[model samples]
Target chain A: MEKRITFKGVWLPLALIAPQIVITAVFFFYPAGQAIWQSLFIPDPFGLSMTYVGLGNFEFLLSDPFYRASFVTTAIFSTLVTVVSMGVALFLAVLADRLIKGSGTYRTLLIWPYAVAPAVAGVLWLFMFNTRVGVITWYLGQLGYDWNHVLNENEAMGLVVVASAWGRISYNFLFFLAGLQAIPRSVIEAAAIDGARFWTRFRTIVFPLLSPITFFLLVVNVVYAFFETFGVIHTITSGGPQQATTILVYKVYSDGFVGQDLGSSAAQSVILLALVALLTVIQFKFIERRVHY
Target chain B: MVEKRGAGLWLTHVGMIIGVAFIFFPIWLAFVASTVEQQAIVRPPMPLLPGDKLVENYTRALTSGVNAPVATMLFNSAIMATGIAVGKIIISLLSAFAIVYFRFPGRQIFFWLIFVTLMLPVEVRIVPTYEVAANFGMLNSYSGLILPLIASATATFLFRQFFMTVPSELAEAARVDGARPMRFFFDILLPMSRTNIAALFVILFIFGWNQYLWPLLITTDPSMNTIVMGIKQMFPSGDDTADWPVIMATSLLAMIPPVIVVISMQRLFVRGLVDSEK
Candidate 1:
């Protein structure tokens, strides 16, 4: 995609790009290279020497119970967060799209939460479910259901997932609404004129048309759950309640910083790097195909 | 119009209202809690309505409350967010200009190098990046907080995509007028990119302000903490009751800037979000 007409200035262009290149090289590439390089070596407890053991860290992570558990936790956490957020967003977007008026008002009301930090969202939810003096918790006590995420593993996981999902609904909503509005009116009108019911029309036409955006949001939401929800987990549980809510990212932090297991944590990071690269490739590929449309 | 509706429209309205309420509930509760006294919150079934203690709690939070005063954290956050937004926009503008407007050596390689950074988020390289920052004595500094995270190429790619759509005749005219490359960039291209720069600023500002883990890792100093990460530090560890009112007040203050940006620039925020993701 070279421009038909371009300025001829080698030095100027190089200088223009130099800042970004330097930052990227120093902060981005250098650290990424280090993560890969460090994954194969284990540091002694004294911080005196490194042992070169190829594939040993990877092997240990694959078989380690906690690492395996983190993997499962990540899968469950990401899936639940993605499903809950996307489902709520899609439902809201559909209803908002159908409104003849006040959609913008609803949008304004709903979208500001996107600006709320994930950590703040976690704190807000935690405050409500605080077990003591928590309005929601106090109400649940009246219903004979004790709500305590502090000790309950599933409850802790559920709380973090919900908190993470709550902040993401606005982002998904915007994309879904845009996708819904992009559907040609005549196509939907044709379906309606053919005597299709609302649910039938939606399931047959609208849902199919929305698959692209849906798939895109799935990847985005998964990535969000993977990385961005660190704040949520940190504030609410700190991956506590017996490490039940510790997703892979949290594990990397805890093991590297807290546990001082550099080799295994670096291994986990390398795996995560690969996962993101794969997802980014898929996302870009989809964008490329969609560009034709 | 597709169809004029009565029952269905009412149902949609009901659904949308419920959705909006669900979205607003947590923040609304936080705001309510922020206004109430500590005892009012600690007691079960806190008042749902706004309390008269709003001024007292917020003032306490800003002036002399918490580990670090909320005011200081807010100032730190403001600086970090503004630095990240302005820095990212400036560098991205220059790089995007170069990519779109000039033919240069190692251009494609340089572009791909920037592109590759997009795939590796800060979380994956946290340990090594932290080590890098620590080695460079960048910890607890504003540059450390802002620089590493702004390495993303999303803004650059966005500007490049936009610049491609700009007609070549504009540049031709500038060249014919004897404008130098940078002179044309400053006088012509920059004016054209104002909307994009503004839109990207809104999104980047929110991103910078909402950052949690990086600041948490680097800025261990109480005075250096950003409000977003500082809120967690205010929480008590043991059975001791947290200053709920003050914490809630800090939460409200922490969110205000980003929320104001989003609401005031709703259109640009949405445009930047949609455009950047592409």
Candidate 2:
């Protein structure tokens, strides 16, 4: 939407935009273009020259068992993180929404977790579940269940998922609470007057109304699980126990920085770029439609 | 108000308390761990209550961390977060004002260019981006930490969204008074955008503070480490147990600034978070 009245000086406007344009071009566009370009070339091991392989890196990455496992691992990891965080958040939001008053007090209690960094959240959870001194792990041992995420694949995945989702709960809770509050009270009342119980009213009327925000949160939580959980995975398990918890982003980091396989990492990055682009498209299209409904 | 939830109301309160407790348990344990000595923590099933060593542990953390003082890491974090937050706000305000208020050539192209940065997070293009930064000699510098990430167009889109709602008559009246484009921007638009700027500042501050991978890659210097990423470095590399007390204290300290910002600016923080979707 253009402003009806706008200033007419081309150079002045161009001057105003120059900083943003230059920074975006240099930092964002150039690097992204280079990722695409680098995906086609293989660099020699000595950090010297590059060979034009032309899709060789992509082919190798697609076929590598480890890379393929990372894909599956990422899928499972993101799904679990999204589900766990969203489920807990929805539960909290519903309970809070049901409060006659003092939801704000509960909100204040719950949402401070939002302020904790994802990496810090990992440390917090890691402390609780730390193999040696972890209070929770010690308690679990009392229950006769051995808990060692460092050496166990499933346990490591679980720890990373929970740690990543821990801080995320607040974000989902805020949105869910907002969504719940935005549902007109009259509709629920109408359902109640028609002899609909609370559960019935929620499932039939309230849930439908909240679907737009639900969908929005789903996409957002998935993205959070995708890119932002790098800290959680890195700190908690280091994507370990045989790369069980290594998501796509972690693999990108590990390969690019640790392994120094620039070509394959660049290819993975290009694939990830495509993934994010697709997610962005899906978000805009679905969210725009849902909001209109 | 739909129906008197009478007994159900009490149940809701109870459930919420449980949910809140479950969420708070981790931080609570961290705090408890921070207060205790190392032996108390390592022996399994550490005392749940705060120990008398609170001051001692926190003092140790602030004065002398493993590699560098936690105080120094905190200082670096504050600089990085504030720099990124303030820098992005200035650039975004300018570009957004120009986009919304001017009829310039290539405006569409510029908008789309800024918009595209949203999809390309630093994680994806780490290698090449690092190479770019290295080429520019940005490593271990504050500018290196802030500049690349500031290119995001979130606040720009937000300003544009708000500007569309602003009455054109405001700009029209300003023009009649013989105000230049930038003068109108400074005199009228800047003041009008105060709440937005404040709200975005709250959110962006947290974003900047929580950064992990970028700071991890760029700042190999111990003194330059931000607290969020620096905590992981405190963990022992091999055999030795972590320094639980100091590490936990550092964890809580790392959280304090952002938590204080969010609680103090709760209303604005929430507004910024919801609005940041653009």
* lDDT tens per residue, model 2, B167-256: 999999999999898888988988999999999999999999999999999999999999999999999899899999999999999999
The per-model lDDT (C-alpha) reads 0.92, 0.90
* lDDT at A168, model 2: 92
Query: Tens digits of per-residue lDDT for model 1 on A1-293?
Result: 66777898799999999999999988899998999999999999988999999999999889999889999999999999999999999999999889868899999999988999999999999999998888889999999999999999999999999999999999999999999999998999999899988899899999999998999899999999999999999999999899999999999999999898898889999999999999999998999898987
Off by more than 4 A, model 2: A290-293
Model 1, runs deviating above 4 Å = none
i-RMS for every candidate (Å) is 1.1, 1.1
Q: Cα lDDT of model 1 overall?
A: 0.92
lDDT of 2: 0.90
Note the residue pairs that clash in candidate 2: none
